[model samples]
Target: MAKGLNRSKLAGCAALAFATLFAGAASADGTVNIYSYRQPDIIKPVLDAFTAETGVKTEVLFLDKGLEDRILAEGQNSPADVILTVDISRLTNAKAKGVTQALDDATVNANLPAEYRDPEGHWFGVTKRARVLYASKDRVKETAITYAELADPKWKGKICMRSGQHDYNLGLFSAAIAHWGPEKTEEWMKGLKANLARKPDGGDRPQAKAIFAGECDLALGNTYYVGLMRTNEKEPEEKEWGNAINVVFPTFENGGTHVNISGAALAKNAPNRDNAVKLIQFLSSHKAQQVYAAQTYEYPVEPGLEPSDVVKAFGTLNADTLSLDEIAKNRKAASEMVDRVGLDDGPSS
Candidate 1:
């Protein structure tokens, strides 16, 4: 398994590598600079493999800061050959801002499903994540529950989740708006807000921890968190956290729970354009995707790549079939609704 990492170094290595190779034009000897939000540790193995296979040095610029803003500031002079990050909304925002350029890669098109990638060739998804529900096994039955049910008076004062302002929560709410419309989505948000056991505070992991501490009967967390806990070699508490819950996929009848991705795009003015394409292709290949899946606990975006064993044990999920674009497009609305409904008070962004 890949070691955990600080987010910034990941960006630096990819971007730095590109800068090193940017001096020439053959693309083979050139480096590929990458601007990424994927923490460095998660992608180190994949990048290392790319370097070993192609002998192309890579540089990365890790930015926890705004990706779109940095790219925009660089304009046509940016050293970035690729932009990698999570969240569909952020990817769409980058495209809208013109920091990303479309690419024609057969490997990307063949491996990733159409919905997971941009309609145009602008970006491609490499992995998937389901925003499933985690409920206390002893306190709650492991039966079916829809996202809308959190608003029911039955769950009032019994729900825990991250702040609504987060990209993940916003994306999930955006999906809600896409499927159920603004009125229904707002209503659902209001109900869910009313039920918050302890204001929406903490990231997915902490939310799960809160459930273990008896802070809430249920919490909203990613599917990977379960796998991380289940497979944790370092933290004994993660195993306990895993054993304490029942993972549930909400609303499979209409559409599955909201899903998102950690995807990539070509930089608008890539110096090592061909190599950038090759790097993306390599990342999307089965071997790299498998490594990514094992490390991050995310589902491979490639159609046929079976999930890592840890993920499979979580059980099959019914994912929302909505195009990620829809979720990204509605992000602003979700953000506003979250603030209006006061879910933003729970966790700090």
Candidate 2:
């Protein structure tokens, strides 16, 4: 069930300031339109809650197609007042393209860390996810390994991963580039590619499944996928999938793993700019943030909200502190390197 929002719990002086700017709805009847890339099943609960509490009947266009491309094509004619999706790289790209506006809100600015939100304020992350390693407990002795170790000779032909072109992979590789200069990171990628157990070919869940089938010893994946597998009520197979591997946070002496996010932005010419701001702020509020973190098995962007018990049971992690914008900015270079080394071909299923 979708949770309800209570304005009484709104935090700090930011709330008082936001109260003045609180525009409930663009239309007289209280409605807003959203264009979302997040799957309907995953995000609908939260949207339902938002609508129920505020009377803001959210009309959504759920597209599996790229949100940026769609918004770009829509141009000024886009009916979208709000944009939602995962991955900092994609949000940063949209910001670069001028598809979203720089939202000026006192509460949003004060509550969100400067690094987490765009410098220009084009977007803010609603929730966070960590990049983690899913290694077979029976095969690997060390419960922990550094990101650089995945390139070691011993790991050669022992690693499983998704397509290098995928945003998550590119984001991790981009972080590697940021940590070490391009040349070393490129060498690392080539070596990592050489070490592939099979051609890198599956989404995170499938890669975890590969480990269960004895196809690989370790697979790169996100923290949330493990949460979903463990908690998904509709699928008994996912419970079996969750049991096959152990989770590891690959800290590169930097002391944490890479983390990404699902974020939101206001459309460039949002007809209901005030209402859009309210909707986004609502998502960032503690109530929505908690629901997002618990439901998605992602880390909440807010400081005090811990992940749900399912995620807590998997264990804890310190996320790599590099600002998401830097990772997004370097994604192009990461993609180029992935192509240069032929990792984009991925493992064959």
Candidate 3:
């Protein structure tokens, strides 16, 4: 409409703008709202891809905590169609809170492993992560390690870890309980606590940082964090922190490595119910599985798929066949054992 515009050019521009607005409007009915506890950077791309593939717009409400509480509080008036989060305990907790509805979809069932999804179908796991070992590149020599070996006197005063109360640690402890029973896991925790390099403090990355500082020679950390730290650009020093150690996917004497899921569930009262199920199905699709795992640095839950190239460098993981459902059942005992063994109290000294 200004000096340079011919009427035809001006009309064309207006038409283009209107078409763009109309395109967005056309997809309004396909919008799937998500209540997610997972960090935005990790899940947004997948959501974007979902929109691109299906014309389904995704609106996310990112929450650091209380996702279940908020959804429950909103009740039937809630717009939350899906809940995206990590950890089996949290998923089980959401189910216990009555915020999620059971989904019965053939595509989801075909894609997710039985061990990774709820038996009642309240959630479907899309990726796999492990609480694996982190050992100093300068000191630890053994390539193969066992979780049981963490308690051996040979490694005394040589290990670093986060608080035993941390969900990451709890996941492992619950898996241990599932594998070894309460009495034995409690004993194992005590001996492992006796081997601490320092008081249980800091998150997983700090454990590797401590190793780099020579405070300890070994640590317990999630596998994905190693990839995140190693590739971190904003915190370049974390790459060095990552380089200081190697991840060891420790296993039980007769079992495979322990692993958990980053998964999503259907909300009980989805405003956009069909679109919500479509979103969940798209998430578990092979393409989404590849993107989600590669971006998040986690292994894909859909079998025959591998984690990103960076995660593969740590070594192949033979995930334990024990159902996460089984591990979840043992969580209460695992938590009690952490307290009973005074794991957070550091060693007996």
Best by TM-score: 3
Please write out the lDDT profile of model 1 over residues 168-207, one tens digit for every residue. 8888899888888999889888888888887777789887
Give the TM-scores of the predictions, in the order they appear.
0.88, 0.88, 0.91
lDDT of each: 0.82, 0.81, 0.87
The Cα RMSD of model 2 versus the native structure comes to 10.5
What TM-score should be assigned to candidate 2?
0.88
Better of 2 and 3 by lDDT: 3
Candidate 2: clashing pairs of residues:
157-195, 199-346, 199-347, 200-346, 200-347, 201-347
Best by lDDT: 3
lDDT of 3 by residue, 251-288 (tens): 99775888889999999988788999999999889999
Show model 2 residue runs off by greater than 4 Å: 1-28, 345-349
The TM-score measured for candidate 1 stands at 0.88
How accurate locally is residue 231 in candidate 1, as Cα lDDT from 0 to 100?
78
Q: Tell me the lDDT of model 2 at 107.
A: 87
Candidate 2 local lDDT, 40-141, one digit each (tens) = 778887887787767777767687776776666555555678889899977887787788999878888767777678888899998888888998878888
